[model samples]
Target: MFWLLFTLFMVACFSAGATGGLFPPGAWYRGLNKPVWTPPDWVFPVTWITLYICMSVAGARVALAEGNGIAMAFWSIQIALNALWTPVFFGLQKIRLGLAVIGALWVAVLLGMIALWEVDTLAGMLFAPYLLWVTIAAALNASVWKLNPEQAA
Candidate 1:
């Protein structure tokens, strides 16, 4: 049972990370005016992959622990929200909605982190990078929205 849950969670995390690339490729993001601190495009995949691995392991740890249903549910909710972000921002080109989704995602991540902390501190800490990344993404999304208010669909 633990292995099954772990595998499922890992698959889900990988799928969520892949959603970021759903956008039409090549310069699709480059043309947009980004914040000065936006890291190079290559940095994103590396960061996201690392974060996803951490999230998967954290989730698996929680699943293997005792009485972690609530934490698991919270993690699932946040991940679902995380998955929606790429589609909203890239697939549908809804920057404002994407910002809103990511904002909610941040809160969900915080809740998941807290829940994980109660069960296992390391699990919670594993989620930290994901939380930080999402927070930064939220800020960037807001900046994009502000800079391209007219561009929002």
Candidate 2:
């Protein structure tokens, strides 16, 4: 049962991740003016893969907990937002809209982490890195939008 739940969560996370492949950051993103603090391109795949595994583990753990409705809901929200951002920013080149999506994602991740913590300590701990990564991603999205006001408009 635990393995099945984990697999289901993994599927969800990876499905969200697939959006990146579908809407890869090509020439447009490379041409954008990014902050000096922007992570190297290689860091993205590595970090996301790690985060996905952790998220899957967290979700699976929380799913089996006594009271996880809110946490699960938040998890679902975050993943959907996660899937939306790549297409908005990379595919449609809507940097401003991407920022909005990521901003909402940040809130959902934070609330989900807290909710998960209430149910299971390890599950919550698993989300810590995900929250941190999302913080960086949101800041990066905002920074990109600010630096490229022309594109943002």
Candidate 3:
């Protein structure tokens, strides 16, 4: 049962991850002015792959736990926001909107982390790296928006 739940959660995470394939950051993103701290292109896929695994494991852990309603809700919210971001930012080329989406995602992840903690300690711990990654992603989004105000407009 736990393995089945884990697979389901992994499907959800990868489904959300599919957005990246659909809306890749091509020349437009390459041309944009990014901050010095921007992560190298190679880092994204590696980080996301690792994060998705962790997210799936955490979701699976909390799925059958008692009092997991809030955790599950937050999990759903975070995944939806996660899927929305790439389309908005890369597909639509709406940097400002992407910032908004990522900002909301950040909040959802933070809440999800806290809520997951309430249900299972290891589940909550799993989200810690995800939260950190999102924080970096949010900062990257904001920096991109700020650095290219003209493009964002």
Best by lDDT: 3
lDDT (Cα, tens digit) per residue for candidate 1, span 1-153: 766777788899878877866664346556777889887778888998788788888998898899898899999999899888888888888889988999999999999999998998999999998899998999999988877767775
TM-score of each: 0.92, 0.98, 0.98
In model 3, the runs with Cα more than 4 Å from the true position are none
Predicted structure 1: clash tally: 0
Q: All models: lDDT?
A: 0.86, 0.93, 0.96
Better of 1 and 2 by lDDT: 2
Model 2 ranges with Cα > 4 A deviation: none
Q: Which ten residues in a row have the lowest lDDT in candidate 1?
A: 21-30
Ranking by TM-score: 3, 2, 1
TM-score computed on alpha carbons, candidate 2: 0.98
Give one clash count per candidate, in the order shown.
0, 0, 0
Q: What lDDT score is found at residue 61 in candidate 2?
A: 94
Q: Model 3: which ten-residue window has the lowest total lDDT?
A: 37-46
Q: Pick the winner on TM-score between candidates 1 and 3.
A: 3
